[model samples]
Target: MSERKPRKDAARNRAAVLAAADELFARRTSPEDEVTMADIAAAAGVGKGTLFRAFGDRTGLIHALYEARVEPIRNAVEEGPPPLGPATPPLQRLPALLDAILCFKLDNRHLALALEGTGSDSPYQAGHYDRWHALLQAVLEQIPGLTDSDFTAHVLLAATRADLVEHLVGQRRLPPEGLRAQLASFTTKVLGSPALPGSPAEQIHS
Candidate 1:
């Protein structure tokens, strides 16, 4: 027998269930909270069996939620900015990358908070940090009069991370613009000079 397509109502129900689960998981408190399949099914107005059939289990559902939320940020960083080229000055590209990074964090604050609450070990976290560190290091390496220990680039990247920004703005009440300027200053200092004079990529550090 040919497989039957799901009825329109069934499709709607599935969508509703996923949406509900997303909301709950996004706001779930404590890893110990019992966010059972039943809770998600009820929230979505679907049957428990439907929920199970749609998503293998709670972990699968959580993973789906995270992927749905975070994919855009990853894409923006990897592709949205100007292409990384030898001719392009890191200083100019750096600001664009920073702007994109900040926008991602601000847009996904709630999801970020949820992820932090889970305390899960994610390769994405390490990979993302490594990528940022690498990019900054590459920029520094291209500049003159600014060679240092390998750890310096990592330290600068870590200092200017999204989590630190969230803490500074959300918890410490620093204006976002002010924080951005301060971070730019710190980054420039860490990198030594923006660019060499007469170089198209050169930028003033101050």
Candidate 2:
């Protein structure tokens, strides 16, 4: 028999779908710039069945996009340097991480709103949220005179919830720079850290 043809191109199809979806959302000024699954499927040059098979549903697709955008921040937290890397002091890292988070939400505001509005449960119950919570809680556990890291992590993450970020940036018109400063200050207060010379908490907005 002649050589068998290679099976269908799953990886290529997935990349195409993600790329198309990213472009569609990147151009979105509002959540109303909604691109349906059929639209993405058409744009990616794939069938609706393939898009569903690859991503399960619209929410799943949205989550995938969120995860993709946030993956770099996650890697930095897991393996990069001071304030984000594992080696950074917990108090410093906490605020720094929050800054990263706030920026991420601001940068991806429209996408975050789309994802946040989905499902009955809090979006924090999903993928990267658990990792962020666990990492933050673990770091908080290392600090002295601090209690309830578990609860603390949940609360901190809530401070960056999509709707709130949207309100601040989209409605209240908070500048990204100003928001970063406010968050850094809030984190410093919550962590009970007096700003020391060049400390992560002190320097986060810098």
Candidate 3:
């Protein structure tokens, strides 16, 4: 019972830490680089020691927060229904998948920036990137006449990169819906088809 109590406390602490970090990143006006583990600990009302023990470092904390935020999208893509699920047609699903990713980056602008900016490791080498690439490549493979699924996947995913999203939204001041329309058109060209009908991007505003 004592051991179970510590485990429960640990889970609770982890949840509190993630929640605090999410709030901090969402609210920050400065670069995410300035948000430290110490800041998260203070905001969570936990000691710095506890925060460090739970997440190891700032990068890990950011990664965890990103994963938590993306969990719903992940589930929808993996198992939920059409336009995102495994059961959808590749032609339609491809645009939906990319649209979902773009929307995620747009919504969590700061958090996405933090994850891509963290550490020295190449963003392309990250586990999340690999999973997205693999899934995209697999979908592309299903479409007829689409060769080089690997390179195509990279290209499509590149369009949704956090920095690019920031540039278009922040620097260019392009509205989110406008960006989505552009992406849909770009994706349509890549797929060698007319603009995809019933795109999941519509659900964003609905």
Leading candidate by lDDT = 3
Give TM per candidate.
0.57, 0.87, 0.94
Residue-level lDDT tens digits of model 3 in 109-156: 888888887746567856688899999999999999989999999999
lDDT ranking of the models:
3, 2, 1
Which consecutive 10 residues in model 3 have the weakest lDDT in total?
Answer: 197-206
Cα displacement (Å) at residue 192, model 1: 2.0
- RMSD to true structure for each model, in Å: 6.5, 2.9, 1.6
Global lDDT scores for all candidate models = 0.58, 0.81, 0.87
Query: lDDT, candidate 1, residue 143?
Result: 62
lDDT at residue 43 of model 2 (Cα atoms): 90
**Model 1 whole-model lDDT (C-alpha atoms):** 0.58
Clashes of each: 0, 0, 0
Q: Residue 175: error of model 1 in Å?
A: 2.3
Candidate 3 at residue 122, lDDT?
65
**Candidate 2 lDDT by residue in tens digits, 98-202:** 878888888888887777766456686666678778878998999999999999999888888888897887788988777777777777788888863553434
